[model samples]
Target: MHNAQPWRFRYHRGSRVFEIRADLERAMPHADPDARGLHIGCGAALLNLRVAAVHEGLHPETLLLPDPADRALVASVGLTGAAAADSGLGALYPAIRQRHSSRFPFDDREIPQPLREALGEAARAEGAALTFPSSWHLDEVLELARESEARNMTDPGGDTDLARWTRLDAASADTTDDGVPYDAFGPRKRGGKSPMRDLAGLREVAGRDAADFERNPQLALLSTPRDHPEDWLRAGQAVERVLLLATLEGLSSSLATQPVEWTDLRWALRDPVSGTGHVQLILRLGYGPEGPGTPRRPASDVLEVLP
Candidate 1:
C-alpha cells in the first residue's frame, strides 16, 4: 500500500504466458493485513502489462487467479498472435510512464464533466465503479482519513510499516528501487483539508517546502460489487486505467488509502443511500505539479525466465 511493490513475475516462453504472483515478503502485515492492497498493486501491474502488450500489437488473454490452490498466483496473461489491439488501451500506453501519484497540492479548479465521465468509463472497463463523492460523503471520508492518520501516529505497527517503506534521505531515495522517496513525498501540508497522506508522517524531510492544498480536493471513490480477492484485483486494474486516462487528460493524481485500511472506517466510506458496493480506493485528482517518479526495481529482479 505504501509503494511496497509487492509482486513478482514469471514468464513461460514455451506457453507464451506471464504469471503474476504476490511477493508476500513485501506485504504490509499492519497496513494491509488481509492482502487486499497487495492484490490491488499486483492488479495495477497486470493492467500495465496489458497496456504494454496492446501497444505492441499483441493480444493479452488474461485469467485472474487461475489456480485456486495457489493463492499467490494473482493472474496469468497469455500472449496470443499479433492482432489489432484495442485502440483505447493502446492510447493509454504513453501514460504508463507519464502517470505519477501527485502528493502535492492541487489547484481548486474543477475537472471538466466530459473528462470526468471518461475517467468513470475507464474504471467501468476494468469491472469497477468510480463516483465523485457528494459533499457530505467527502467530509466523512476526509474525517476518516484524518482519524486513520491519527491512529497511525499512535500505532507502533503502523509506524513501523511506514518507516520501513519510506525513504527519508536523499541517498536512499537515489539508491533504493522501491518505497516512496523523499522527493515524491511532495510539500508538507501547511493548510487546507485535502486528504493526501503524509508518507513522511512526523518525520521531517530536508528541502521539503510547505504549501496549502485545495480546500475541496477533487476526490473519486473506486468500488466493486463484492469484497474478494478477485474484486480487489479488478479494483486495482480499474484504478490504474482511471489514472492512465487522467494522466492523458492533463490531470495529476494520488491515492488516499488510509480510510480504506481500517475496517470500521471502510464500512463508513460506503454511500449511505446505495450501500451496494465495496469501496476499494480514494483518489485525489486535480491540476498542479506532477509527483516525481519513484524508483522501480529492475525488470530482471522481479521477472523470471522459465522454459
Candidate 2:
C-alpha cells in the first residue's frame, strides 16, 4: 500500500502453491517502461505473501522467473510440509503496515552494529546482498547521484513524467493519488536535485528544511547477481525484507534508485575491491525522521481472481 502494489496471486489448494503475476497497466511508462520498477514492486508484494504464509506455520519454496511464455507471471511459491514457525518472521509482519518510505532527514546518529548485522541477515534470507558503502564508496555514490540529477534535468521526457507525478501543491486535490505527493518530499541540498522525490521535478513543492539535509547519512546498497526481471523482483523482495527488519528494530529508511538508474554510473557503483555484482538500489538507513505514507489503489483495483 505504500507505493506500487501490483500483484495477482492464484493459490492452488491441491498443490498448496501461490502463483505471482505482474500487472503491467500499473507500470510507469516514462520512468519504468521496461517494468524493472514494476517487477521490483511486485516482487516486494510476493515477499509479503511469503512472510504471511510463513506466519501461518508453513515453509515457503519460491520458483523465480518460472515461466518464459508468461513473462508477466514472475514466480510460483509452494508451501513445504514443515510446520515450524519463525518467531523472527512473526516479529516483522506487524511492521509491514507501519512501514512507509521516509524521505526526511535522519537523526544524524550512527547506526548500531547489531542493527546493521540484522538488516544484512534479513536480505540474505531473500537471496540478495545489502551492503553499506565505505567513505570512499559513499563519495562515489554521491557523484552518481549528481549525474542522475543532470541526466533527468536534460531529458525532457523524463522531466515531464517526474513533473506529473511529484505533487508539491499539498492543496492540489486534482493530482494523481498513486505516486509521491508534494508534502512528503524532503528539502533540496545546495546544488543537488530534490533526491528524485516520487514526483518528477518539483523540488520546491516537496518541502524540506535547508538546515536538515543529511550530510553523512548511512547508505546501503541492495545488489543482485544479474539484472533481469527476476533479479529486480528479488531485489525488491530484499528491499522490503530489510526495510521491515529495520522498522522493527526502531530504524527509519529511504530508497534512492538514482545511482542505479544511470547505466555508466551504475557500473561505477560496483566495487572492484569487493567483487560484488550490479547495484539495484541505494538506500539511506539510520536513526532519523520518518515520512508520511503515500497513496495506493485499493486491493480490488489490482487483484483479480481467475479460474
Q: Which candidate has the top score in TM-score?
A: 1
Candidate 1 structure quality by residue, lDDT tens digits, 1-307: 7788999999999999999999999999888999999999999999999999998889889999999999899999999977464557888999998987888888899999999999999999999999998678888888898898788777788879888999999888888999998888888889999986788878888888999999988899999999999999999999999999999999999998988989998998887788788999999999998878888889998999999
What does the lDDT read for residue 209 in candidate 1?
A: 95
- State the C-alpha lDDT per candidate: 0.90, 0.73
Model 2: weakest 10-residue lDDT segment is 191-200
Candidate 2 lDDT over 1-307, as tens digits, reads: 2255567777777777888888766666776767787888888888887778777777778898888999888988889866455536656788878888887767668898888888988888877988887777777777787788777767777766665555666665245557567566655444322243334353454335543456676888888888888789888889989988888888888888766666778888886587768788888877867777777666676555444
Global fold similarity of model 1 (TM-score) = 0.97
Error of 2 at 216 (Å): 0.8
Assess candidate 2 and give its lDDT: 0.73
Residue 208 lDDT (model 2): 52
